[model samples]
Target: MVAKNQTVVTEFLLLGFGDLHDLKFLLFAFLLIIYVMALTGNALVIVLVMIGQNLRSPMYFFLSQLSLSEFLFTSNILPGMLWLTLAGGGKISIIRCFSQFYLLAVCTVTQCLLLTIMSFDRYVAICKPLHYTIIMTFGLQLQIVTLCWSTGFILSIVLFGFLYRLEFCGPDTINHFYCDIGPVLELSCSDISSTKLVTSMLSTPLVVCPFVLITATYISIFNTILKISSSIRRQKAFSTCSSHLTVVCLYFGSLASIYIFSPKIGSNTKKNLSLIYILVTPIFNPLIYSLRNQDIRGAITKYIHLIGTWQLP
Candidate 1:
Protein backbone atom coordinates (compact mmCIF):
# COMPACT_ATOMS: atom_id res chain seq x y z
CA MET A 1 0.00 0.00 0.00
CA VAL A 2 2.38 2.64 -1.20
CA ALA A 3 1.39 6.09 -2.32
CA LYS A 4 4.10 6.97 -4.82
CA ASN A 5 4.20 10.74 -4.25
CA GLN A 6 3.60 10.82 -0.49
CA THR A 7 5.99 10.93 2.43
CA VAL A 8 4.41 9.57 5.60
CA VAL A 9 4.51 12.04 8.45
CA THR A 10 5.34 10.31 11.72
CA GLU A 11 5.22 13.41 13.90
CA PHE A 12 4.10 17.02 13.83
CA LEU A 13 5.60 20.23 15.13
CA LEU A 14 3.01 22.02 17.24
CA LEU A 15 3.70 25.73 16.90
CA GLY A 16 1.90 26.55 20.13
CA PHE A 17 1.99 30.20 21.04
CA GLY A 18 5.60 30.32 19.86
CA ASP A 19 5.40 34.04 18.99
CA LEU A 20 5.19 34.88 22.69
CA HIS A 21 8.94 34.80 23.26
CA ASP A 22 8.96 36.72 26.52
CA LEU A 23 5.52 35.58 27.67
CA LYS A 24 6.00 31.81 27.38
CA PHE A 25 6.38 31.37 31.12
CA LEU A 26 3.43 33.62 31.73
CA LEU A 27 1.36 31.57 29.30
CA PHE A 28 2.40 28.36 31.04
CA ALA A 29 1.50 29.76 34.45
CA PHE A 30 -1.86 30.95 33.21
CA LEU A 31 -2.70 27.61 31.64
CA LEU A 32 -1.61 25.71 34.73
CA ILE A 33 -3.78 27.85 36.95
CA ILE A 34 -6.77 27.35 34.66
CA TYR A 35 -6.25 23.60 34.51
CA VAL A 36 -6.11 23.36 38.30
CA MET A 37 -9.21 25.49 38.78
CA ALA A 38 -11.18 23.58 36.16
CA LEU A 39 -10.25 20.28 37.72
CA THR A 40 -11.08 21.38 41.25
CA GLY A 41 -14.36 23.08 40.35
CA ASN A 42 -15.74 20.19 38.32
CA ALA A 43 -14.48 17.66 40.81
CA LEU A 44 -16.18 19.51 43.66
CA VAL A 45 -19.46 19.41 41.75
CA ILE A 46 -19.18 15.64 41.32
CA VAL A 47 -18.32 15.15 44.99
CA LEU A 48 -21.12 17.38 46.17
CA VAL A 49 -23.64 15.66 43.97
CA MET A 50 -22.54 12.30 45.23
CA ILE A 51 -22.68 13.06 48.97
CA GLY A 52 -25.51 15.58 49.18
CA GLN A 53 -28.76 13.76 49.94
CA ASN A 54 -30.73 16.80 48.83
CA LEU A 55 -29.08 16.59 45.37
CA ARG A 56 -30.57 13.19 44.56
CA SER A 57 -32.91 14.65 41.96
CA PRO A 58 -32.56 14.12 38.22
CA MET A 59 -31.24 17.64 37.64
CA TYR A 60 -28.31 17.29 39.99
CA PHE A 61 -27.57 13.78 38.73
CA PHE A 62 -27.31 15.03 35.16
CA LEU A 63 -25.25 17.98 36.34
CA SER A 64 -22.74 15.62 37.98
CA GLN A 65 -22.40 13.82 34.66
CA LEU A 66 -21.89 17.14 32.89
CA SER A 67 -19.23 18.07 35.39
CA LEU A 68 -17.47 14.78 34.75
CA SER A 69 -17.56 15.43 31.01
CA GLU A 70 -16.17 18.94 31.43
CA PHE A 71 -13.45 17.60 33.69
CA LEU A 72 -12.41 15.06 31.09
CA PHE A 73 -12.74 17.55 28.25
CA THR A 74 -10.27 20.00 29.74
CA SER A 75 -7.89 17.31 31.00
CA ASN A 76 -7.65 15.85 27.50
CA ILE A 77 -6.07 18.94 25.94
CA LEU A 78 -4.76 21.29 28.64
CA PRO A 79 -1.79 19.22 29.80
CA GLY A 80 -0.39 18.95 26.30
CA MET A 81 -1.10 22.62 25.76
CA LEU A 82 0.75 23.56 28.92
CA TRP A 83 3.81 21.57 27.86
CA LEU A 84 3.75 23.05 24.38
CA THR A 85 3.54 26.53 25.86
CA LEU A 86 6.42 25.94 28.23
CA ALA A 87 8.58 24.39 25.53
CA GLY A 88 7.63 27.16 23.10
CA GLY A 89 6.24 24.59 20.69
CA GLY A 90 7.16 20.94 20.41
CA LYS A 91 6.77 17.80 18.33
CA ILE A 92 3.85 15.45 18.89
CA SER A 93 3.81 11.90 17.60
CA ILE A 94 1.13 11.17 15.04
CA ILE A 95 -0.33 8.38 17.16
CA ARG A 96 -0.48 10.67 20.19
CA CYS A 97 -2.09 13.35 18.08
CA PHE A 98 -4.77 11.01 16.83
CA SER A 99 -5.42 9.76 20.34
CA GLN A 100 -5.99 13.29 21.56
CA PHE A 101 -8.21 13.96 18.57
CA TYR A 102 -10.37 10.93 19.34
CA LEU A 103 -10.83 11.83 23.00
CA LEU A 104 -11.63 15.43 22.14
CA ALA A 105 -14.31 14.34 19.72
CA VAL A 106 -15.80 11.99 22.27
CA CYS A 107 -15.92 14.65 24.97
CA THR A 108 -17.44 17.20 22.61
CA VAL A 109 -20.22 14.86 21.54
CA THR A 110 -20.88 13.68 25.08
CA GLN A 111 -21.20 17.22 26.39
CA CYS A 112 -23.66 18.11 23.65
CA LEU A 113 -25.90 15.19 24.53
CA LEU A 114 -25.58 15.84 28.26
CA LEU A 115 -26.56 19.50 27.94
CA THR A 116 -29.56 18.57 25.83
CA ILE A 117 -30.59 15.99 28.41
CA MET A 118 -30.21 18.59 31.16
CA SER A 119 -32.56 20.88 29.25
CA PHE A 120 -35.11 18.09 28.97
CA ASP A 121 -34.81 17.54 32.70
CA ARG A 122 -35.54 21.19 33.32
CA TYR A 123 -38.46 21.09 30.90
CA VAL A 124 -40.04 18.18 32.71
CA ALA A 125 -39.48 19.71 36.14
CA ILE A 126 -41.04 22.99 35.05
CA CYS A 127 -43.68 21.90 32.54
CA LYS A 128 -44.86 18.63 34.10
CA PRO A 129 -43.89 18.85 37.76
CA LEU A 130 -46.39 16.23 38.98
CA HIS A 131 -45.09 13.54 36.58
CA TYR A 132 -41.43 14.56 36.73
CA THR A 133 -40.47 12.03 39.35
CA ILE A 134 -42.06 9.09 37.55
CA ILE A 135 -40.66 10.19 34.20
CA MET A 136 -37.10 10.82 35.42
CA THR A 137 -36.32 7.99 37.76
CA PHE A 138 -32.85 7.06 38.94
CA GLY A 139 -32.63 4.05 36.64
CA LEU A 140 -33.78 6.09 33.66
CA GLN A 141 -31.18 8.78 34.27
CA LEU A 142 -28.44 6.13 34.49
CA GLN A 143 -29.56 4.57 31.22
CA ILE A 144 -29.55 7.96 29.49
CA VAL A 145 -26.09 8.78 30.80
CA THR A 146 -24.79 5.42 29.57
CA LEU A 147 -26.35 6.01 26.18
CA CYS A 148 -24.74 9.46 25.86
CA TRP A 149 -21.24 8.18 26.62
CA SER A 150 -21.66 5.16 24.36
CA THR A 151 -22.88 7.28 21.47
CA GLY A 152 -20.03 9.70 21.93
CA PHE A 153 -17.43 6.90 21.85
CA ILE A 154 -19.04 5.20 18.82
CA LEU A 155 -19.29 8.43 16.84
CA SER A 156 -15.75 9.41 17.65
CA ILE A 157 -14.58 6.09 16.23
CA VAL A 158 -16.44 6.85 13.02
CA LEU A 159 -14.67 10.21 12.72
CA PHE A 160 -11.37 8.61 13.71
CA GLY A 161 -11.78 6.16 10.84
CA PHE A 162 -11.89 9.06 8.41
CA LEU A 163 -8.75 10.59 9.91
CA TYR A 164 -6.93 7.25 9.76
CA ARG A 165 -7.20 7.06 5.97
CA LEU A 166 -5.62 10.45 5.33
CA GLU A 167 -2.01 10.66 4.17
CA PHE A 168 0.04 13.35 5.83
CA CYS A 169 2.84 14.09 3.37
CA GLY A 170 4.54 17.42 3.92
CA PRO A 171 4.16 20.54 6.04
CA ASP A 172 3.98 18.64 9.29
CA THR A 173 3.57 21.75 11.39
CA ILE A 174 0.29 22.28 13.27
CA ASN A 175 -0.35 25.98 13.74
CA HIS A 176 -2.24 25.53 16.99
CA PHE A 177 -1.64 24.02 20.39
CA TYR A 178 -3.41 20.69 20.19
CA CYS A 179 -4.40 18.37 17.33
CA ASP A 180 -7.43 20.27 16.13
CA ILE A 181 -9.29 18.82 13.15
CA GLY A 182 -8.75 21.75 10.78
CA PRO A 183 -5.01 21.89 11.35
CA VAL A 184 -4.58 18.14 10.99
CA LEU A 185 -6.70 18.02 7.87
CA GLU A 186 -4.62 20.84 6.36
CA LEU A 187 -1.54 18.63 6.52
CA SER A 188 -3.16 15.76 4.65
CA CYS A 189 -2.05 15.18 1.07
CA SER A 190 -5.15 13.11 0.31
CA ASP A 191 -8.18 14.46 -1.45
CA ILE A 192 -10.16 15.64 1.56
CA SER A 193 -13.38 16.85 -0.05
CA SER A 194 -15.27 13.75 1.03
CA THR A 195 -13.73 13.94 4.49
CA LYS A 196 -14.72 17.56 4.96
CA LEU A 197 -18.20 16.90 3.67
CA VAL A 198 -18.71 13.94 5.98
CA THR A 199 -17.28 15.87 8.93
CA SER A 200 -19.59 18.81 8.35
CA MET A 201 -22.56 16.51 7.93
CA LEU A 202 -21.69 14.70 11.12
CA SER A 203 -20.92 17.75 13.24
CA THR A 204 -23.83 19.92 12.09
CA PRO A 205 -26.55 17.65 13.47
CA LEU A 206 -24.69 16.97 16.68
CA VAL A 207 -24.33 20.65 17.42
CA VAL A 208 -27.51 21.96 15.86
CA CYS A 209 -30.09 19.32 16.70
CA PRO A 210 -29.39 19.42 20.43
CA PHE A 211 -29.26 23.20 20.33
CA VAL A 212 -32.65 23.36 18.60
CA LEU A 213 -34.12 20.96 21.10
CA ILE A 214 -32.76 22.96 24.03
CA THR A 215 -34.07 26.21 22.56
CA ALA A 216 -37.55 24.80 21.98
CA THR A 217 -37.54 23.18 25.39
CA TYR A 218 -36.77 26.54 27.01
CA ILE A 219 -39.44 28.30 24.97
CA SER A 220 -42.02 25.91 26.36
CA ILE A 221 -40.50 26.20 29.82
CA PHE A 222 -40.72 29.99 29.81
CA ASN A 223 -44.25 29.89 28.50
CA THR A 224 -45.26 27.54 31.30
CA ILE A 225 -43.57 29.80 33.85
CA LEU A 226 -45.39 32.87 32.49
CA LYS A 227 -48.78 31.20 32.81
CA ILE A 228 -48.26 30.49 36.53
CA SER A 229 -50.40 32.91 38.62
CA SER A 230 -48.12 33.28 41.64
CA SER A 231 -45.14 35.59 41.03
CA ILE A 232 -43.05 33.67 43.58
CA ARG A 233 -43.64 30.36 41.77
CA ARG A 234 -42.75 31.95 38.43
CA GLN A 235 -39.58 33.39 39.88
CA LYS A 236 -38.60 30.06 41.42
CA ALA A 237 -39.24 28.23 38.12
CA PHE A 238 -37.08 30.68 36.21
CA SER A 239 -34.33 30.46 38.83
CA THR A 240 -34.05 26.69 38.33
CA CYS A 241 -33.42 27.17 34.61
CA SER A 242 -31.26 30.29 34.63
CA SER A 243 -27.99 28.49 35.38
CA HIS A 244 -28.44 25.91 32.66
CA LEU A 245 -29.51 28.66 30.26
CA THR A 246 -26.46 30.72 31.05
CA VAL A 247 -24.21 27.72 30.53
CA VAL A 248 -25.88 26.86 27.23
CA CYS A 249 -25.47 30.42 26.01
CA LEU A 250 -21.79 30.53 26.94
CA TYR A 251 -21.07 27.07 25.50
CA PHE A 252 -22.84 27.43 22.17
CA GLY A 253 -21.89 31.09 21.74
CA SER A 254 -18.19 30.35 22.04
CA LEU A 255 -18.50 27.27 19.84
CA ALA A 256 -20.32 29.21 17.11
CA SER A 257 -17.84 32.06 17.37
CA ILE A 258 -14.90 29.83 16.55
CA TYR A 259 -16.26 27.06 14.34
CA ILE A 260 -19.19 28.65 12.54
CA PHE A 261 -19.23 32.43 12.51
CA SER A 262 -15.53 33.33 12.30
CA PRO A 263 -13.93 30.84 9.99
CA LYS A 264 -11.90 33.61 8.39
CA ILE A 265 -10.39 34.80 11.66
CA GLY A 266 -6.66 34.44 12.32
CA SER A 267 -5.29 31.25 13.91
CA ASN A 268 -4.38 33.10 17.10
CA THR A 269 -7.91 34.38 17.36
CA LYS A 270 -9.24 30.86 16.97
CA LYS A 271 -6.96 29.61 19.74
CA ASN A 272 -8.19 32.31 22.06
CA LEU A 273 -11.79 31.35 21.33
CA SER A 274 -10.90 27.73 22.01
CA LEU A 275 -9.86 28.76 25.52
CA ILE A 276 -13.30 30.19 26.24
CA TYR A 277 -15.18 26.92 25.86
CA ILE A 278 -12.35 24.61 26.83
CA LEU A 279 -11.04 26.28 29.98
CA VAL A 280 -13.20 29.22 31.00
CA THR A 281 -16.59 27.56 30.70
CA PRO A 282 -15.62 24.43 32.59
CA ILE A 283 -14.10 26.35 35.49
CA PHE A 284 -17.14 28.57 35.68
CA ASN A 285 -19.65 25.68 35.82
CA PRO A 286 -19.30 25.07 39.55
CA LEU A 287 -19.32 28.78 40.28
CA ILE A 288 -22.44 29.35 38.20
CA TYR A 289 -24.37 26.47 39.74
CA SER A 290 -23.22 27.21 43.26
CA LEU A 291 -23.98 30.90 43.12
CA ARG A 292 -27.36 30.46 41.48
CA ASN A 293 -28.54 27.33 43.25
CA GLN A 294 -28.60 27.36 47.06
CA ASP A 295 -28.36 23.54 47.20
CA ILE A 296 -24.74 23.25 46.06
CA ARG A 297 -23.53 26.09 48.28
CA GLY A 298 -25.23 24.51 51.30
CA ALA A 299 -23.67 21.17 50.44
CA ILE A 300 -20.24 22.80 50.27
CA THR A 301 -20.69 24.47 53.63
CA LYS A 302 -21.84 21.23 55.24
CA TYR A 303 -19.00 19.26 53.70
CA ILE A 304 -16.45 21.78 54.95
CA HIS A 305 -17.88 21.64 58.45
CA LEU A 306 -17.76 17.84 58.38
CA ILE A 307 -14.11 17.97 57.36
CA GLY A 308 -13.30 20.50 60.06
CA THR A 309 -15.05 18.43 62.76
CA TRP A 310 -13.11 15.34 61.67
CA GLN A 311 -9.83 17.22 62.00
CA LEU A 312 -10.53 18.27 65.61
CA PRO A 313 -8.55 16.70 68.50
Candidate 2:
Protein backbone atom coordinates (compact mmCIF):
# COMPACT_ATOMS: atom_id res chain seq x y z
CA MET A 1 0.00 0.00 0.00
CA VAL A 2 3.07 2.29 0.30
CA ALA A 3 3.62 2.50 -3.47
CA LYS A 4 0.87 5.12 -3.88
CA ASN A 5 2.05 8.75 -4.05
CA GLN A 6 -1.02 10.67 -5.25
CA THR A 7 -1.85 14.15 -4.04
CA VAL A 8 -5.46 14.34 -2.98
CA VAL A 9 -7.60 17.39 -3.68
CA THR A 10 -8.30 19.43 -0.55
CA GLU A 11 -11.15 21.56 -1.89
CA PHE A 12 -13.67 22.03 -4.71
CA LEU A 13 -15.00 25.12 -6.40
CA LEU A 14 -18.76 24.91 -6.92
CA LEU A 15 -19.84 26.70 -10.05
CA GLY A 16 -23.41 26.95 -8.88
CA PHE A 17 -25.15 29.71 -10.80
CA GLY A 18 -21.68 30.54 -12.04
CA ASP A 19 -22.86 32.20 -15.21
CA LEU A 20 -24.34 35.22 -13.43
CA HIS A 21 -21.18 36.64 -11.94
CA ASP A 22 -22.51 40.18 -11.73
CA LEU A 23 -25.61 39.19 -9.76
CA LYS A 24 -23.99 37.01 -7.14
CA PHE A 25 -24.46 39.54 -4.38
CA LEU A 26 -27.98 40.35 -5.43
CA LEU A 27 -28.83 36.69 -5.74
CA PHE A 28 -27.16 35.97 -2.44
CA ALA A 29 -29.27 38.53 -0.60
CA PHE A 30 -32.46 37.35 -2.36
CA LEU A 31 -31.74 33.70 -1.63
CA LEU A 32 -30.91 34.54 1.96
CA ILE A 33 -34.36 36.06 2.39
CA ILE A 34 -35.99 33.01 0.88
CA TYR A 35 -33.97 30.74 3.13
CA VAL A 36 -35.06 32.63 6.22
CA MET A 37 -38.69 32.54 5.17
CA ALA A 38 -38.55 28.84 4.38
CA LEU A 39 -36.96 28.00 7.69
CA THR A 40 -39.47 30.03 9.69
CA GLY A 41 -42.47 28.87 7.69
CA ASN A 42 -41.70 25.18 7.86
CA ALA A 43 -40.74 25.42 11.50
CA LEU A 44 -44.03 27.10 12.19
CA VAL A 45 -45.87 24.29 10.44
CA ILE A 46 -44.14 21.75 12.64
CA VAL A 47 -44.91 23.70 15.79
CA LEU A 48 -48.54 24.21 14.96
CA VAL A 49 -49.11 20.61 14.04
CA MET A 50 -47.47 19.38 17.19
CA ILE A 51 -49.06 21.89 19.58
CA GLY A 52 -52.54 22.33 18.15
CA GLN A 53 -55.01 19.74 19.33
CA ASN A 54 -57.04 19.99 16.14
CA LEU A 55 -54.02 18.79 14.12
CA ARG A 56 -53.91 15.41 15.88
CA SER A 57 -54.92 13.54 12.73
CA PRO A 58 -52.49 11.34 10.84
CA MET A 59 -52.48 13.77 7.91
CA TYR A 60 -51.27 16.70 9.98
CA PHE A 61 -48.87 14.43 11.86
CA PHE A 62 -47.25 13.47 8.55
CA LEU A 63 -47.26 17.07 7.44
CA SER A 64 -45.30 17.94 10.57
CA GLN A 65 -42.71 15.30 9.68
CA LEU A 66 -42.46 16.64 6.12
CA SER A 67 -41.91 20.11 7.51
CA LEU A 68 -39.13 18.83 9.76
CA SER A 69 -37.39 17.19 6.81
CA GLU A 70 -37.69 20.30 4.64
CA PHE A 71 -36.19 22.48 7.37
CA LEU A 72 -33.10 20.24 7.76
CA PHE A 73 -32.76 19.75 4.01
CA THR A 74 -32.76 23.47 3.33
CA SER A 75 -30.26 24.09 6.09
CA ASN A 76 -27.95 21.37 4.75
CA ILE A 77 -27.50 22.80 1.23
CA LEU A 78 -28.28 26.53 1.31
CA PRO A 79 -25.71 27.79 3.83
CA GLY A 80 -22.84 26.21 1.94
CA MET A 81 -24.15 27.47 -1.38
CA LEU A 82 -24.43 30.98 0.06
CA TRP A 83 -20.85 30.81 1.29
CA LEU A 84 -19.63 29.69 -2.13
CA THR A 85 -21.49 32.57 -3.75
CA LEU A 86 -19.81 35.11 -1.49
CA ALA A 87 -16.29 33.72 -0.96
CA GLY A 88 -15.59 32.55 -4.56
CA GLY A 89 -14.45 29.13 -3.29
CA GLY A 90 -15.95 26.57 -0.94
CA LYS A 91 -13.68 23.83 0.35
CA ILE A 92 -14.91 20.48 1.56
CA SER A 93 -12.62 17.69 2.70
CA ILE A 94 -12.89 14.26 1.06
CA ILE A 95 -14.59 12.61 4.01
CA ARG A 96 -16.82 15.65 4.50
CA CYS A 97 -17.83 15.53 0.86
CA PHE A 98 -18.97 11.94 1.07
CA SER A 99 -20.79 12.69 4.33
CA GLN A 100 -22.63 15.64 2.77
CA PHE A 101 -23.58 13.60 -0.27
CA TYR A 102 -24.97 10.81 1.90
CA LEU A 103 -26.96 13.23 4.06
CA LEU A 104 -28.33 15.00 1.01
CA ALA A 105 -29.34 11.74 -0.60
CA VAL A 106 -31.01 10.49 2.57
CA CYS A 107 -32.97 13.70 3.11
CA THR A 108 -33.95 14.02 -0.55
CA VAL A 109 -35.14 10.44 -0.88
CA THR A 110 -36.95 10.55 2.46
CA GLN A 111 -38.89 13.59 1.30
CA CYS A 112 -39.86 11.77 -1.88
CA LEU A 113 -41.14 8.80 0.08
CA LEU A 114 -42.89 11.02 2.60
CA LEU A 115 -44.76 12.81 -0.14
CA THR A 116 -45.95 9.53 -1.59
CA ILE A 117 -46.97 8.29 1.85
CA MET A 118 -48.87 11.49 2.53
CA SER A 119 -50.69 11.08 -0.76
CA PHE A 120 -51.63 7.54 0.07
CA ASP A 121 -52.95 8.67 3.46
CA ARG A 122 -55.17 11.19 1.72
CA TYR A 123 -56.27 8.65 -0.86
CA VAL A 124 -57.44 6.23 1.80
CA ALA A 125 -59.36 8.85 3.75
CA ILE A 126 -61.11 10.28 0.73
CA CYS A 127 -61.76 7.17 -1.36
CA LYS A 128 -62.09 4.54 1.32
CA PRO A 129 -63.57 6.30 4.33
CA LEU A 130 -65.06 3.14 5.75
CA HIS A 131 -61.63 1.53 6.03
CA TYR A 132 -59.52 4.68 6.61
CA THR A 133 -59.25 4.25 10.37
CA ILE A 134 -58.44 0.57 10.15
CA ILE A 135 -56.00 0.90 7.27
CA MET A 136 -54.13 3.95 8.55
CA THR A 137 -53.85 3.02 12.20
CA PHE A 138 -51.32 4.82 14.39
CA GLY A 139 -48.92 1.88 14.42
CA LEU A 140 -49.10 1.53 10.63
CA GLN A 141 -48.57 5.26 10.18
CA LEU A 142 -45.47 5.09 12.35
CA GLN A 143 -44.22 2.13 10.39
CA ILE A 144 -44.67 3.85 7.02
CA VAL A 145 -42.85 6.94 8.19
CA THR A 146 -40.02 4.89 9.72
CA LEU A 147 -39.63 2.80 6.57
CA CYS A 148 -39.37 5.91 4.37
CA TRP A 149 -36.44 7.37 6.37
CA SER A 150 -34.73 4.00 6.85
CA THR A 151 -34.83 3.09 3.17
CA GLY A 152 -33.52 6.52 2.25
CA PHE A 153 -30.44 6.14 4.46
CA ILE A 154 -29.79 2.57 3.31
CA LEU A 155 -29.83 3.60 -0.36
CA SER A 156 -27.76 6.70 0.30
CA ILE A 157 -24.87 4.80 1.88
CA VAL A 158 -24.86 2.19 -0.88
CA LEU A 159 -24.60 4.78 -3.67
CA PHE A 160 -22.07 6.91 -1.84
CA GLY A 161 -19.87 3.87 -1.15
CA PHE A 162 -19.42 3.21 -4.85
CA LEU A 163 -18.67 6.87 -5.48
CA TYR A 164 -16.03 6.94 -2.74
CA ARG A 165 -13.82 4.41 -4.51
CA LEU A 166 -13.21 6.38 -7.72
CA GLU A 167 -10.03 8.44 -8.15
CA PHE A 168 -10.22 12.14 -9.02
CA CYS A 169 -7.26 13.01 -11.26
CA GLY A 170 -8.00 16.65 -11.93
CA PRO A 171 -10.62 19.29 -12.82
CA ASP A 172 -11.59 19.65 -9.18
CA THR A 173 -14.16 22.30 -10.00
CA ILE A 174 -17.64 20.84 -9.45
CA ASN A 175 -20.05 21.94 -12.16
CA HIS A 176 -23.14 22.52 -10.02
CA PHE A 177 -24.06 24.38 -6.86
CA TYR A 178 -23.82 21.63 -4.31
CA CYS A 179 -21.78 18.43 -3.92
CA ASP A 180 -24.26 16.46 -6.02
CA ILE A 181 -23.19 12.97 -7.03
CA GLY A 182 -23.26 13.47 -10.81
CA PRO A 183 -20.73 16.30 -11.03
CA VAL A 184 -18.40 14.62 -8.52
CA LEU A 185 -18.62 11.37 -10.40
CA GLU A 186 -17.70 13.14 -13.60
CA LEU A 187 -14.42 14.14 -11.93
CA SER A 188 -13.27 10.60 -11.14
CA CYS A 189 -10.38 9.16 -13.22
CA SER A 190 -11.01 5.55 -12.33
CA ASP A 191 -13.44 3.24 -14.14
CA ILE A 192 -16.86 4.37 -12.93
CA SER A 193 -19.09 2.85 -15.58
CA SER A 194 -20.48 0.30 -13.18
CA THR A 195 -20.92 2.90 -10.48
CA LYS A 196 -22.68 5.19 -12.93
CA LEU A 197 -24.92 2.38 -14.07
CA VAL A 198 -25.72 1.38 -10.52
CA THR A 199 -26.50 4.96 -9.51
CA SER A 200 -28.96 5.35 -12.37
CA MET A 201 -30.55 1.98 -11.70
CA LEU A 202 -30.69 2.63 -7.95
CA SER A 203 -32.29 6.02 -8.49
CA THR A 204 -35.06 4.64 -10.69
CA PRO A 205 -36.65 2.68 -7.88
CA LEU A 206 -36.77 5.65 -5.50
CA VAL A 207 -37.72 8.24 -8.10
CA VAL A 208 -40.01 6.53 -10.59
CA CYS A 209 -41.83 4.00 -8.45
CA PRO A 210 -42.96 6.51 -5.85
CA PHE A 211 -44.12 8.94 -8.53
CA VAL A 212 -46.21 6.26 -10.21
CA LEU A 213 -47.71 5.35 -6.86
CA ILE A 214 -48.59 8.99 -6.16
CA THR A 215 -50.19 9.36 -9.59
CA ALA A 216 -52.23 6.22 -9.12
CA THR A 217 -53.33 7.32 -5.66
CA TYR A 218 -54.51 10.64 -7.04
CA ILE A 219 -56.35 9.00 -9.91
CA SER A 220 -58.40 6.94 -7.49
CA ILE A 221 -58.90 9.98 -5.27
CA PHE A 222 -60.24 12.04 -8.16
CA ASN A 223 -62.51 9.17 -9.27
CA THR A 224 -64.03 8.94 -5.80
CA ILE A 225 -64.63 12.69 -5.69
CA LEU A 226 -66.38 12.58 -9.06
CA LYS A 227 -68.74 9.87 -7.82
CA ILE A 228 -69.85 11.86 -4.77
CA SER A 229 -73.55 12.81 -5.13
CA SER A 230 -73.22 16.18 -3.43
CA SER A 231 -71.47 19.04 -5.22
CA ILE A 232 -70.48 20.46 -1.83
CA ARG A 233 -68.79 17.22 -0.86
CA ARG A 234 -66.89 17.15 -4.15
CA GLN A 235 -65.81 20.74 -3.60
CA LYS A 236 -64.58 19.93 -0.12
CA ALA A 237 -62.51 17.05 -1.39
CA PHE A 238 -60.99 19.14 -4.16
CA SER A 239 -60.19 21.94 -1.77
CA THR A 240 -58.19 19.60 0.47
CA CYS A 241 -56.47 17.63 -2.27
CA SER A 242 -55.81 20.61 -4.54
CA SER A 243 -53.12 22.11 -2.31
CA HIS A 244 -51.47 18.73 -1.69
CA LEU A 245 -51.67 17.78 -5.37
CA THR A 246 -50.15 21.08 -6.42
CA VAL A 247 -47.19 20.52 -4.08
CA VAL A 248 -46.80 16.95 -5.35
CA CYS A 249 -46.77 18.02 -8.98
CA LEU A 250 -44.21 20.79 -8.46
CA TYR A 251 -41.88 18.65 -6.33
CA PHE A 252 -42.18 15.48 -8.43
CA GLY A 253 -41.99 17.28 -11.77
CA SER A 254 -38.85 19.20 -10.82
CA LEU A 255 -37.19 16.17 -9.15
CA ALA A 256 -37.78 13.92 -12.15
CA SER A 257 -36.66 16.62 -14.58
CA ILE A 258 -33.32 16.98 -12.79
CA TYR A 259 -32.11 13.77 -11.11
CA ILE A 260 -34.14 11.23 -13.10
CA PHE A 261 -33.49 12.78 -16.51
CA SER A 262 -30.00 14.22 -15.99
CA PRO A 263 -28.56 11.28 -17.91
CA LYS A 264 -30.19 12.59 -21.07
CA ILE A 265 -29.17 16.21 -20.42
CA GLY A 266 -25.89 17.96 -19.59
CA SER A 267 -24.77 19.70 -16.38
CA ASN A 268 -26.03 23.19 -17.19
CA THR A 269 -29.58 22.05 -17.90
CA LYS A 270 -29.53 19.79 -14.89
CA LYS A 271 -28.34 22.57 -12.58
CA ASN A 272 -31.05 24.92 -13.82
CA LEU A 273 -33.75 22.36 -13.11
CA SER A 274 -32.11 21.38 -9.85
CA LEU A 275 -32.83 24.86 -8.51
CA ILE A 276 -36.55 24.22 -8.90
CA TYR A 277 -36.50 21.48 -6.29
CA ILE A 278 -33.57 22.43 -4.09
CA LEU A 279 -33.97 26.21 -3.97
CA VAL A 280 -37.52 26.95 -5.02
CA THR A 281 -39.62 23.99 -3.91
CA PRO A 282 -38.91 24.49 -0.22
CA ILE A 283 -40.14 28.07 -0.53
CA PHE A 284 -43.28 26.93 -2.30
CA ASN A 285 -44.44 24.11 0.02
CA PRO A 286 -45.76 26.30 2.84
CA LEU A 287 -47.24 28.82 0.43
CA ILE A 288 -49.15 26.24 -1.56
CA TYR A 289 -50.32 24.16 1.38
CA SER A 290 -50.84 26.65 4.21
CA LEU A 291 -52.26 29.53 2.21
CA ARG A 292 -55.04 27.51 0.64
CA ASN A 293 -55.99 25.36 3.60
CA GLN A 294 -58.63 27.21 5.62
CA ASP A 295 -57.60 25.79 8.98
CA ILE A 296 -53.96 26.71 8.47
CA ARG A 297 -54.95 30.16 7.34
CA GLY A 298 -56.94 30.73 10.50
CA ALA A 299 -54.12 29.46 12.65
CA ILE A 300 -51.67 31.78 10.90
CA THR A 301 -54.00 34.75 11.27
CA LYS A 302 -54.47 34.07 14.97
CA TYR A 303 -50.73 33.71 15.38
CA ILE A 304 -50.06 37.05 13.75
CA HIS A 305 -52.75 38.80 15.80
CA LEU A 306 -51.53 37.27 19.02
CA ILE A 307 -48.02 38.39 18.34
CA GLY A 308 -49.17 41.82 17.27
CA THR A 309 -51.36 42.45 20.29
CA TRP A 310 -48.75 41.45 22.84
CA GLN A 311 -46.81 44.37 24.38
CA LEU A 312 -45.05 45.30 27.58
CA PRO A 313 -46.90 47.49 30.15
On TM-score, the leading prediction is 1
Off by over 4 Å in 1: 1-6
**lDDT agreement of model 1 with the native:** 0.89
Clashing pairs in 1: none
Query: What lDDT tens digits, residue by residue, belong to model 2 across residues 138-234?
Result: 8998898899889888999898889878777566888777888888888777788999899888877778898899999999999999999999999
Q: Least accurate stretch of 10 residues (summed lDDT) in model 2?
A: 1-10
Largest lDDT belongs to which candidate? 1
What is candidate 1's lDDT per residue for 170-288, written digit by digit as tens?
A: 88998888997888888888888888888788788888899999999999999999999999999999999999999998988887776665568988888889878778888888889
lDDT of each: 0.89, 0.83
lDDT at 186, model 1 = 85
